[model samples]
Target: MIATFGGGCFWCTEVIFQHTKGVKEVLPGYMGGQRENPTYEQVCSGATGHVEVIQIDFDESQVSFQDLLEVFFKTHDPTTLNRQGADVGTQYRSVVFYHDDKQKQEAEAFIQALEEAKVYDSPIVTAVEPAVTFWEAEDYHHDYFNQNPQNQFCQVVIAPKLQKFLKLYQQ
Candidate 1:
């Protein structure tokens, strides 16, 4: 099944999902935007209404959507509006662009449950919206963490998230 999530940088989400057992592929892209074929720079400008998202293809039999949801909610600060870490702007806003009614319902219910449980100290601001056209980012963005392990951003920001994910879910 396909799941598209906009949770801060696609770089971070892309790396985490790539390490997931059942995730067949994680493609970095722009979603929840009105612009067609938006470039990374345009999305970064936060004027195109695009969010940096990763469109994931996962095998539900191996890793349930619930598992993915758990990881997504836990790894990032969903309470923060239009930001994740130092990355701030509309493009970094938390969102789940569901492809179908089931996905929409599931995402909504997940957020509801989290709210009820008081999972975060603050309210969950993650938006659950219908999936829109996914414009795949440039080829250089694909597998960015793998390719740019030595990058400062990858080392300082993404590495820690990867470690935490491996500890919590990959155990």
Candidate 2:
């Protein structure tokens, strides 16, 4: 199964999904943008209309799409618009690019359930859209958290988010 999500910074999002049991691979990339083969600097300008996304190839037999959505919602603040911590831009918008009808329906249902359960203090703003062209980010952007664990942004931002996810969804 394949899942693509743009919650905020791909570095943080990729790190969280990497620890999930059934995830086979997590590739950090750019999606939902107008530019083709956009560079990191170009996307950072926020004019490309691309959101930093992570494409996760997982084993559905072990981890369902619904399960992946659950982790996605929990790991990021869906209520925030175009921002996550210091990462602020349309590139940081909350979005899910579904690859199939079933994934689309499941994503919609999950958002509906979250709204009904009042999981967020504010309405969920996660955009459910069809999967678009995904341009893989440069090599340095991939596994950024793992590579730069001591970096201030990773320490203060990504680390806390990862910790929250692990504590909330310990298996």
Candidate 3:
């Protein structure tokens, strides 16, 4: 099964999903945008209206979509609108582009449960839209954290999140 999520940087989200046990592939991409085949530079300009997203292909039998959602919510601040930590823009918005009705329903239920349970201090602003065309990111963006572990942003921003996710999910 496939699940697409946008919860800040695609690089960060990609790294997290990559560490998941049943996730076969986590392709960093641009989605929920007006532009066709948007480039990273174009999306970064915040003009393309594309959110940095990851198209994850996972084994549902090994890891449920709900499990993926749990990891996603715990790792990122879904309560914030169009921002995550230092990254701020529409491209960094919290979103879930559901592939089908089941995903859409599940996402809605998940958010409802979180709200009812008061999971966050603020309400979750994560958008649950129908899946759109996924424009795969440029080659360099793939497996970014693994490829450039020493990069300053990776160390200061991504590494800590990755650590927390690993501890929480044991991935």
63 Cα displacement, candidate 3 (Å): 0.5
Query: Residue-wise lDDT of candidate 3 within 12-77, one digit each (tens)?
Result: 899999999999999999998899999999999999999999999999989999999988998899
Top candidate (TM-score): 3
Q: After superposition, how far is residue 136 of candidate 1 from its true place, in Å?
A: 0.2
The clash count of every prediction, one per candidate, is: 0, 0, 0
Query: Which whole-number lDDT from 0 to 100 does residue 46 have in model 1?
Result: 88
Better candidate number, 1 or 2, judged by lDDT: 2
TM, every model? 0.97, 0.97, 0.98
Model 1 lDDT per residue over 1-171, tens place: 999888999999999999988999999999887889999999999899999999999999998887888888887899999999999999999998988898888899999999999878999999999988999999999999999999999999999999989998755
Question: Would you list the C-alpha lDDT of every candidate in the order shown?
Answer: 0.92, 0.93, 0.93
Model 2 weakest lDDT span, ten residues long: 79-88
Ranking by lDDT: 2, 3, 1
lDDT of 2 by residue, 1-171 (tens): 789999999989999999998999999999998989999999999999999999999999989999999999988889999988778999999999999999999999999999999988999889999999989999998899999999999999889889988898788
| TM-score of candidate 1 relative to the true fold | 0.97
Q: Is candidate 1 or candidate 3 better by TM-score?
A: 3
